[model samples]
Target: MKKRFRILVTGSAGFIGHHLMLALQRAGHHTVGLDALNNYYDPKLKFRRLQEQGFNTEEIKYDTLLSNSTLHGSYFIQLDLADAPALQQLFKAQAFDIVINLAAQAGVRHSIDHPEQYVASNLVGFANILECCRRNRIKHLLFASSSSVYGLNQDIPFSTSHRTDEPISFYAATKKANEVMAHSYAHLYSLPITGLRFFTVYGPWGRPDMAYYIFSKAIVEGKPIRIFNYGDMLRDFTYVDDVVEGVMQLLDVKPATGKAPYKLYNIGNNQPEQLMEAVAILERLLQRKAKLDLHPIQPGDVRATFADVEDLALETGFKPQTSLREGLSKFIDWFKMYHKINEVHALQEG
Candidate 1:
């Protein structure tokens, strides 16, 4: 029988974090979710995600546990990772069996403008997490890396073995730094750590800042949707469920003791989709037309991203399986409902 472990999922209000928290709860684990609930995009959306996980957003206070009514053995707290003392207290109190560090300032473009946010959250916050894990003697620590780390490689399918020193964006650089930092901790502290290099994950309750969500909104509102690199980008769009499944599977599979006690894998769909193709599918799903504003690729943007999931498959016996059309359809359905969009008006008026 599989052991029921106590787990901590940082960034629990975020997209992947929310889905992963629910999955862990369903698997009968005692789960504690923590999020700073920053205003990078919208705090309301983050609160909504917390609410979905049975947290009372109105009653939430920092460093306080909000028990879940619907899901037993689940709890949440609003806390910042940058607060070392608070984080230390939480780690001491919870003594989690596993820690999944998903808390970080996301978005390459946003990082270009707000480098300080990236440094504080991605670097400092992550350092705090590592310290806590080491102090608590956590059994396993799984953190989110990014496909962006493969910047300027020109490799068709980015592999864990490939060189990643030349990150094109500040965001990617921070993630790359995370990989090396975690490795150092693993080597020194003998902590079992795994870094998941996630591809373009999307689904219901995804971040509004993503290209698909933004394009969907603009298309429905009859506003112009900007296509970067003249719609000549490629992405390995992995679905949320698939990503969650991979994480769940790897939860029990910790790194070996002798091999630096650390490992990295690309959790992505092996298939890459063209940018225009994805937009077309979204248009079809929404039954709307998009005003294309073709432009050169913005700074900090990559021309393509394709994940080499061979290592992931070998390690976890899983790979992302959701097709782009199916995933986008689910996202569109959720988007309309979340935005309270009337289908008739959205299609005909736009």
Candidate 2:
């Protein structure tokens, strides 16, 4: 029998974290979650996510203990990742066997305008996590990295072995910094660290800032949708469930200690989908046509992203296999139900 470990998942109220939270609890592993609930997009959705995890939003207070009775009394807390003292205290109190750092300042465009937020959250907050992990002697640490680190390399399928030195956006640069930083910590402290470079992850409970959510909303509400690069982009859009599956499998597979207890893998669908094609699928799902506003690609945007998941597959015998349409269909089903957009006009007015 596999040993069950106590796990801490940061960004637990976020899309990917929330999904992983449920999975961990169902698998009979004790899970603790932490989220800042910042208004990066909308705190309303974040609250709803917490509710889904069986936490009452009315009782939400910073640094306060919250747990879900329905999910085997799983613990959760509302706290910023940058709060070092709080994090350290939590680490010491919880005595977690595994820590997954999914909390970070997400969004490439937002990083351009608010670079300071990125620095505080990604850099400073991550340093705090590394310290706590080192001090607490946690067995393993896993962090969410992004494919944007590829930075328009023109490499057909981005591989883990490829150079990630040229990150085009501040967000990507920060993620690259995380990879190197984690490597150093793993080397110096002998910490087992695994980094996942997720592609365009999408599905239900997804971030509103992502293209899929934005386009879906626009199409549903009969508004114009902006298509960048004249909708000529390609993305290895990995579904949220698939990403979670990869993470779960990797949790049991630690890095071999020789040089450094560190490993990085590209967690993606390994299948690139066209931007316009995804839009078309959305239109079919929503039964509405989108008013297209074609524009040049924005700065910090890449033309295409393709992942080489050979290492991931070989290591874990798992690969992201969700088809774009199937994943989008599931997301649309949840989206419509979540937003109560059965009657589009009401959602538009509100």
Candidate 3:
């Protein structure tokens, strides 16, 4: 019989967190979701994700806990991690066994202009999480790190052992800081921590800020899509499902007891695809050619990103198996439905 424990997934309204919550519930684990639901993108999509969990968020207020009606033992709260007192109180009341901190101010370029957001959520918020986990005696803590930590790196496949000190963006700096901070906590408090360095995670219900999502919208709207780095970008583009799977498999696989009870692994497709190639796939799927607006690389953006997920595979007997075309196809399926932008091409008799 598989042992099921109560898991707290922050950013539960987020793309990957939402998927992971369902997966955990499927595995018979009690889940609690926490998201600020700020207008980072659109609260409508976030609330829609919550509703998928059977939550009625119309009257739901901040720092309030609401249980899901359909899914038993599932709950959600609109709370920010930076709210230290509230977070600590929740951890106390919930007595969570495992904590997955996926909530963070995401975006590489956005972080350049909005460093305070990153600091509040990624720095202060993360510190609050660590403190709570330590006091609550949580079994294991798994936090989402990003491939952005490998910023300005020429390494083809970014390994956990690779030098990560030279981050090019404020976002990357925050993530790198997270890894270091996690290591310190794990070392001191003996709290087991696993840092997941995720590659370009993409799929259905993905972040609208992502390039693929933007491409889909622009393709459907007959608008020009920005192709940064003059179409020379490369990314592993790991599917969200693959990332959720990796997290599930590693839920019970806690770090070692001795020394720093911490581990870091890259969760990626291991197959880097070109930026133009992804756009081409989107064009093929939407049945509309993308008007490319090639431009120089943006500040706080890398030319390429690839992951060395051997450690993840070695730890758990799995690696990302979703192909880029298949993943993009699935995303577009949801995109059309969500955005309601189905191709209305007419086949008039010629």
What are the TM-scores, per candidate, against the unseen true structure?
0.95, 0.95, 0.95
Over the stretch 204-297, how does candidate 2's per-residue lDDT look in tens digits? Answer: 9999999999999888778999999999999999999999999999998899998899999999999999999999999998888999999999
Candidate 3, residue 137: lDDT:
94
Off by over 4 Å in 2: 60-73, 343-345, 348-350
Higher-lDDT candidate of 2 and 3: 2
TM-score of 2: 0.95
Tens digits of per-residue lDDT, candidate 3, 1-350, equal 68988889999999999899889878889888899888889778888888887678775544434322233387888899988988887887777889999999989888888899999999999999999999989999999999989887787888999999999999999999999999999999999999999999999889989999888888777789988889998888999999999999999999997789999989999999998999999989988899989899888888888888888888898777889999999997888777765348422211
Locate the minimum summed-lDDT window of 10 residues in model 2.
64-73
Give each model's whole-structure lDDT: 0.90, 0.89, 0.87
* Poorly placed runs, candidate 1 (over 4 Å): 61-72, 344-350
Per-residue error for 260 in candidate 2, Å, reads 0.5
Instruction: Score candidate 3 by lDDT.
Output: 0.87
List model 1 lDDT by residue over 28-56, tens digit each: 99988999999998888998898899888
Q: Which stretches of candidate 3 lie over 4 Å from their true place?
A: 59-72, 345-350
Candidate 2 local distance difference test against the native = 0.89
RMSD to truth, every model: 2.9, 2.5, 3.8
